[model samples]
Target chain A: MSVLEISELTKSYPVPGGGEPRRVTVVDVPRFVVSAGEQVALEGPSGSGKTTLLHLIAGIVAPTSGRIVVAGHDMTALGEAARDKVRARHIGYVFQTFNLLQGCTALENVAMGMAFGTGVEAGRARELLERVGLADRADFLPRQLSSGQQQRVAVARALANRPALVLADEPTGNLDRRRAREALALMREVCAESGAALLLVSHDHDILSQFGRVETMAAINRAFATADGNSPVETR
Target chain B: MSRVPHHPVALLVRRSLRQHALSSAVTMAAVALAVGLVMSVFSIKDQARNAFTGGTMGFDAVLGARGSPLQLVLNAVFHLETSPGNIPWSLYEEIRRDPRVALAVPFALGDNYHGFRLVGTTEKLFADFEYRKGRRFEVEPGGRMFDPTRREAVVGSYAARRTGLRVGSTFQPFHGLFFDPDTQHEEEFTVVGVLKPTNSPSDRVIWIPIEGVYRMEGHVLRGSGEVYTPSPHEEIPDEHKEVSAVMLKLRSPAAGMALNQTVNRQGTVATLAWPIAQVMADLFERIGWAHRILTLVAYLVVAVAAGTILASITNTINERRREFAILRALGARRRTVFGTIVAEAAALAGLGSLAGYVVYLAIVATAAVIVRAQTGVVLDVLAWHPVLVAAPAGMTLLGALAGVLPAFKAYATDVASNLAPAS
Candidate 1:
């Protein structure tokens, strides 16, 4: 069974001008799927709509037209509040900037992921921090940590609720080469151990090659394919 | 760990405030100042009204020569104003013998010791003059009520302390209601007593015998501005004597109406006043506009404080756009973000109002002694007024209203746009 499935997804933003409004198509994907426990990397240059596709799958952004099913829930048919509930119950997001709340500690940042659910799972957060090699740094605030350590904390927070799918958008974007490779390995190892599917976006070919299955935004996004004359790939 | 889990909104607000510690402190201080001003205004107004009304509760009616009834009560009871005119001393005898009269204490004004008023009356003032309900004047230790026949005096506690006059001290009276050393009466009186503190306007007066005033060199009934100096052997006539005003206590509260009507009908002889009613009406009539203006100013200050909170939060929300987006990406609903901002505002107002109330009490505690000494009104620092509750509640509502614009901004934050690498 697929943990995340998308078909005919489209997103366009209205650009206001002196005359009538014009539509700019940002994302146009025909079909995409991530099987349970599979690790897939989506590589795209800037403005290729990789982040927009990730946001659409995570239910963080509404698609213009599509059917998106994440962990058995049809996200496209649900209202915003219900989509938020579905995201909280089944999806985890790790941003490129390691956007930890400034004054909160590592443990608190992790616990905050579960705060919107029924109750905060502090024990689970602590266990996840330990799994991410941040057990000794749980009480350290984001400013106190180095970039690599902050990224590790963000990874721990993303897995705090043990969701079925984890989304990582250039999680190593701020780290040195060695630290980026190490952070990638840590995220993949943690996700595998927790039996969660991983969908990561990166523009680096070296990191893209590390995943078992790699898909290019030019091969998945119809908007990029049409603009660049790159042919779309068939879904596996 | 047994720590209770806080809501996400609460935690976020806590973190946000902690991140912006200086702004939060400044906002809270502004709120505290506004709340303190409002609370002090309400409290002082209540205490002042209480002191003024309570001070006159002992006497039901005041009888003096035809004049403003409020002025008659102010001069006779509170010693706050000069007497309008004097009624003949024979009227005191008639009022004393009236069936409806319970107690009739005569007062003779127009004399001063230093700045304190010098009242001339019989010992009936000490024995029967009720300062508060069921409370009468008592002489302090090592002192006794002065004899009316000799040149003796009884000074109120405040007056004794202020004038440095003890039981054996001698002081001459000034010729008028205000002290003038050049116009001092030649006859001096010995302070035979110091009255205990009564927390009334009477606390600032010196009591002398009515004969002492009449026998003075310049107080004879020769009309206005006349200075009469009789020879040592000359006799002072009884018909020429006068008393400033008479404080009356009716035998039955119902007799007040009839007695007031009777006195007013005396046709230029005298006018009667119900002390409490007349003083209250006069007080509201005279200072009412100022009070309302002050109250409006205080509320405007509170509104400005709310506006300050609104501006502070809205200004910071621009920088917090990404943080709010992060929360939404972590599955927090827009309402959650909205409520977090609103909660932040309410928390500021709540804490600020509480701090302001503490500040107000501190001020009142520090001012209590000075107020009592100056106005004979003791402020109860811990006394609860409705404004104590209403002020904070209003501030909280104002804070919520202040939060609306910022909360809406937070609610409309674009999660995907903020989280994108382009951002």
Candidate 2:
């Protein structure tokens, strides 16, 4: 079953007051889908709104006009509160800067994401932190850790709830190349092992080759096509 | 399959408070100072009111030669200061004989030992006077109220306690050649009674009969041949009469105004004053400037403390904004964001109020000794109520107002944008 399906997605932001209000139309998607257990990357230029589409799918940002189905739930039909509940139930976000809560230790940061889950077990949080090779640094606050270590904590937090949809927005933007590769590999392995549909947004083309599926923003918006079975150009 | 979700909002707020512990302490200190200032001022005011009321419980009016109302109350009620002029004792007797006057006690002041004043009045003075707990002077190591026929005296609580005077202790009123020369009489009076400590001015006075005071004055003049009595023990001629002030108790306190009007019309020698009204009027007049100044000072202190709290919270918001955005992204409702900030402000205010209250109590305790020495007013420093101590609700309100600017900034944060690529 498709874990996520989007049709006719559009997003517009109004320009600041000046001349006639200039509107930036970012997304004009006709159709897209990611089946369960799929690993995909959305590659685009800086202004292509790959992050925006990821946010919409994760229920953090609302789409201007579209129907989005994630994990068999029609996200567009849910109110803001219900959307939050749905996102909490299924989505895990790995922000680029690591965005680990500064005050909390690495273990605490991972456990925090599981606090709202009905079956959120502390053992799972500890196991995931151990999986990220951060078990020794579990009690160390985010500020005390190095950049790569912080990113590992973020990854641990994303997997803490064991969600079905994992969204990564430039997850390796601030990392070195080696750390970036390690993070990308770890995320891929973790998401596949957990059976989560991973939709990663990134400008780094180096991370895209490992993913089985690729969609450029323009192709996803129906502006281009390729010979592959996937409607959007795979680019490789 | 039913999927379990993460609960991030509660976790975030709890961690936020722990992370900002130092800032929270600073905010709490500010709140404490504001609360303490308000609490101290209110307590002092209440104590002062209680002391003044307790000290002047009895006494309907004071009659004397025209003078300051404060002076008149001090002389007639507290027996601490002197009246401006003397009224004839015969006039006091006339007033005492009236059906409308329940009891009239005449106070004749002209002498002092050390700095404590000596007051001469009849035994009726002690009978009419009442102190707390109904414990009067029992004259336990001394004698009783001296007979009006004898040149004997009764020592006040403080005088007897300090000077070690017992019954039959004789003291002479020896005036120096210069220095006011108010009491030049060398008449000796034996102490017949020692007053119990009343914690009022009565504790510091020496009392004798009016006739003994009159006899002493006549005896002083007799040696100089300026004035002579028929004999040393005989009463002085009526022409040499003198009484410093008269304290009159009315059958009805409500008749004070009428009594004052009637006495003011008397052609002899005396002025009438309703002491309670005069003391209130004097208090009102003095309160205008002093109360205003104290209140202004208290307000400024609280305002500054509140300003410090506001600054602390405002500075913290920038560092916390990203965290707030993370909370919003993690499914924290907008009201939750609002509530967290408000809770922080309230906590700071409550903690600060407690700190300030402690500081206030310490100050009052240290200053109480000095205050008693200087003004003879004893302030119970620890007398406080929780509701009275929490006087910074206004300061807390202002702190909340200051917190709103930051909370609004936190709530309006774009979670996706903040969590997006920095480049």
Candidate 3:
């Protein structure tokens, strides 16, 4: 069964104009799917609607028209509140900036992931932090931790709920080469251990070869094709 | 995350406040100052009322020369002001013999010992007068009431302490209610006794025999201000005797209205004043306006403090837009984000009010002694009034209301745009 499935998905925004407003589509994907526990990487250059696609899949943003099924829930048919509940119960997200609550300790940040849906389990959050090799840094606030350590904490928080799928957007964007490699390896290990499918978005070419399956946004996002004709759609 | 099930919004609020420590402190201080001002007003008003009502408990009516009822009560009961005029000694005797009068204690004013008023009265005042219900005056240990024949005095404990007069101390009396060194009487009175503290205006008085005041040089009758000098063999005339006011206790509380009407109907020779009613009415009439104005100002301060909370939280929400967006992405509903912001504002208000109450208590505790010394009003900081509870509750509600704008802004935040790489 597919953990995430999208068909005919698109997102658009209206640009204010002196005359009539014009709508610009940002994400246009005909079909996309990730099998249960599958590790897929979506690579795209800047302004290719990569982040918009991730947001649409995670149910954070509603699509203009499409079917989006995450962990068997039809996100497209659900309201914003229900979609949030679905995300909390079955989907986890890791942002490019780590996005840890500034004053929250690492363990607390992880615990907060489960705060809305199932109620926070401190033991589970601590265990996840330990699994991410941050057992000694559980009490350290986001600002106190190094970039690599903060990313590790974010990964731990994403996996805190043991969701069916984890979406990471440029997880190692702020890290050094070695730290980025370490963060990527830690994310992969945790996702595999939790039996959650991984959908990672990044523009970094050096990290592409490490994933088993890689999909480029240009291949799927129809909105990117007409805007940048020199770029060719390709997937490997 | 330590095995405790904590609300995420609560954690977020705490974290947010900690992140902006200086702003939070300033907001809390503003709230504290407003609460303190409000609570102090409430406490002072309550204490003053208690002192006024409690001080007049011994007397039901004041009979004095035609004058303001309020001034009569103030002079006769609280010793707060000078008597307007003198009533004839025969009127005191008439009230004492009246069927409706339970007790009539004559007060002869126009004399001061040091700065304390020298109240000229009989020992019946000590034996019959009740300061509070069933609470009578008691002489301090090893002290006794003064003898009426000799120039002896019984001082209240407060007066003794304030004037540094002991049982063997002798002091010359000043000729008027206010002390004047040039008008000092040559006759000296010995302090033969000291009364225990009564927690009333009585505690600030020096009690001397009424006959002793009549015998003093320069003493005059009700209509005469002539200085009466007794020759070596001449007896003082009884018709020349006078008293400042007569404090009357009624046989029944219901008889007070009848006796008061009777005394006032007997022409302008003497007027009846109900001590409690007159003092309270005077107090509410005079101090009531100031209380209302102060209360309005205090409420305004609280409202402004709430506005401060609103401004502070709204400012924070604007800066924390991205942080909230990240939480929304983490599966928090918009209401959750909204609630977190509201909770932050409420927390600031709740903690600020709590701190404000503590500050109020500290101020009341520190001022209690001085307030009692000056106004004879005991300020009990532990006294529980409904306003104490209402003030904080109102402040917290105002704070939550203040959070409404900021919370709505947080709820309507654009998660996608805020989380975008460009943003």
lDDT of 1 by residue, B224-326 (tens): 3343444555665655667888888888767877877777764567888865555566776699788899889988989889988999899999898989988
lDDT of 2 by residue, A1-236 (tens): 89999999876667557998776555568899998989889887665657677778877778778899988888888887677777767778788888887977787777766654433576787788788888788788888999999988888888777778888889999999999999989988888889998889887879888777898876885432322323231111
DockQ per candidate:
0.40, 0.27, 0.49
lDDT per residue (tens digit) for residues B1-423 in model 2 = 112224344455456667778877766776676677677767777666666655344566777776665777766556555567676656777887988787778887767665556777888777755544455554556368888888887887766766677787987764421224465567788888887666665766778887776666443322222444435656666545656777776778657767767776643356776755457456756776876787788888777776776677678777777777666565555666776676666556766676776878876776665554434456788776554634756666766776676677777766776664532
Q: Candidate 1: what lDDT?
A: 0.83
> What overall lDDT, based on C-alpha atoms, would model 3 receive against the true structure?
0.83
Off by over 4 Å in 3: A19-21, A229-236, B1-5, B54-56, B179-187, B216-227, B230-235, B362-371
Clash-forming residue pairs, model 2: A115-B7, A116-B6, A116-B7, A117-B5, B31-B352, B31-B353, B32-B352, B32-B353, B32-B356
Winner on DockQ between 2 and 3 is 3
B9-83: candidate 3 lDDT, tens digit per residue: 878888889999998999998888788778888987777676676544578788888978888888877777778
TM-score of predicted model 3? 0.94
Model 3 alpha-carbon miss at residue B299, Å: 1.3
Interface RMSD of each: 4.9, 7.6, 4.6
Which candidate do you rate higher for DockQ, 1 or 2? 1
> Considering summed lDDT, which 10 consecutive residues are worst modelled in model 1 chain B?
B222-231
| Residues A120-160 of candidate 1: C-alpha lDDT, one tens digit per residue | 87788888888888888888889999999999999888887
- Which structure is stronger by TM-score: 1 or 2? 1
The Cα error of candidate 1 at residue B404, in Å, is 0.8
